[model samples]
Target: MKPKTPRISAVDLFCGVGGLTHGLVRSGVDVRAGIDLDPSCRYPYEANNSAVFVERDVNEVTPAEIKSYVGGRKGYSLLAGCAPCQPFSTYSQSGRSKKRGLDWQLVSKFGELVSQVQPDLVTMENVPQLQDHEVFEQFLGNLHGYSVSASVVECIKIGVPQSRKRLVVIASKLGALEIEAVGKKGNSVRTVRQEIADLPPIAAGEKHADDPLHAASSLSEVNMKRIRASKPGGTWRDWDPELLAACHRKTTGATYPSVYGRMEWDAPAPTITTQCFGYGNGRFGHPEQDRAISLREAAMLQTFPRDYKFLADDETVTFSRLGRLIGNAVPVRLGEVIGEILVEHVRKAEKGTLRPISEELSGRLF
Candidate 1:
């Protein structure tokens, strides 16, 4: 008898714009459905992978719904849950009042779904800060019978073009299983200027009507003037004496200089933020162009393929939403690395040669 081929199946939770879903699909996994609360995700999620997207909050998702999507499919059932991690980010830790502390409950809530679905495999991608949360530890403890692995990983080491760090966890219910070590860093890191320099130039706070995704956000006249005066890798100090904000002149202002600078064309872009399209936000200004990175450029730095379509309409989408979607995503390249890791594990399992990580990363990204 011929040996069986692995039938891949996955369900993405908190699927913001389907970045993970797209990567899994690229690696030959059949993504059953993407579950999230935003109705806006439905179009892109469905359009890109043809996977149905549930516009329901994860708190309300039931096992029956998951079962219906799986439908007795005889393949690996991967429940990849990437709960929102803004509450655990370092940015949240320093300012904005700790009143919005990490919501530790989401992990346990996700655990409830895992207990119900009892998938062959489970994975989660989140901010590195989450690794220290008690709630995160509890979520790992809940996986009693499975081999669990969690690590604070550098996304660039995994081939993501940007510098983003995430905590990744992989667990298997069938038996002890762990993700393989990431290989040594790839040849040359992809830089911010290299990725988006080819696009047609657009001015600050302007939109490119041709390709909706290529549109640059319109800056306020004041901010636009600031961007024009901004130097690559230089901050507010570069501004003319009169142009300097009152905040910058204050005693507490020196520390915020990374906020309003342009990216260096030869280096990787600054980590994308929810406000990346704004020139005054996070060194997001273009190197030579007097504008922040465009929507397409932001997504590209997230490692989404250039042609990855986010919409099916001619109507324009706002930069705020675009920034949120791109910034929140696990780089699709990083997702592919996870998918490839899963693929290798599956392959090894078939050959009876699989091995588990020994207490996660000890040194290096590998």
Candidate 2:
């Protein structure tokens, strides 16, 4: 008889648009359900993956509810959480005021759930800066008996077509756990051209007749002129001095050269943000088009499948809403990395081939 398939059931906390769920499912994990507070995510999270979408805050969810999602599952239980990362993101840190209040507490709450649920395995992905915060220490403290391994993963090195870095953590109650490595054996980093060049071009403010999310946001005449002069991988400095924004004329604004820039076709795209749909946001302008990258292109940079559905048949495509959803999502490709590791971690544990927890955490970060 063929060897039995490894049994792994997962419940995703703060699942945005099912990025993590889709990745996990793609890697052969049985993702049971996704929990999030956003009603807008309900359609996509459930539609793309074979998982129920629980429309509720992570804080409101009890261990019992999470257990029910994994009820009667056989081999291993996994709890995945990618809490709202804004609080720990570098952008939020560089702003005038520090991001705090309820969002900060959410990390604590994620720790609390891990302590309460005590699943066989746990995974979390977040901004790299989070590892520096005290909350991260508290989160580690909650894992009394688990061996944990965390590293700052370079997205491009992991087969993602974007220049992004994220903190990925895996903890297991059984023996030692390690994320299976990839992308080191002549695996070339994917590029913007590789991911989105095939997409039919659309003008600024125009939506594709066939794909609603392919629409680009409209630009003001001044912004249009600026984009027309912008070159791939070039910044607003490429424009005539007369075309410069009032702020760009100042020394402080000169330091923010990434704004109003165009992405290079051969390189990985800049980190996608909530305002990526706007021409003025980051280096979001298309390589040669006089328009910002559309909602669909932004999603593709985040490693969302081309056909990934973000809206229902009757729903209208709103730029701000969809941009927030797409930008805030954890890259689906990274999620697959997380899933592949956990599956192998389980397989090794069952065969008694894993190391002890004490030996594994010595050099965890990569």
Stretches of candidate 1 above 4 Å error?
A: 1-5, 90-103, 174-181, 184-187, 355-365
Models 1 onward score TM values of: 0.90, 0.95
Worst 10 residues of 1 by lDDT: 357-366
Clashing pairs in 1: 205-217, 205-218, 205-219
Instruction: Give candidate 2's TM-score.
Output: 0.95
Report, for every candidate in turn, its global Cα lDDT versus the true structure: 0.76, 0.87
Scored by lDDT, model 2 comes in at 0.87
- After superposition, the stretches of candidate 2 with alpha carbons farther than 4 Å from their true spots are 1-5, 93-99, 179-186
Best by TM-score: 2
Clashing residue pairs in candidate 2 (N, C-alpha, C atoms within 3 angstroms): none
The positional error of residue 81 in candidate 1, measured at the CA in angstroms, is 2.0
lDDT string, candidate 2, 179-293, tens digits: 4443332447999999999999899999998999899999999999999999999888888998999989888997999999999999999998888999897999999988999
Number of the top candidate by lDDT?
2
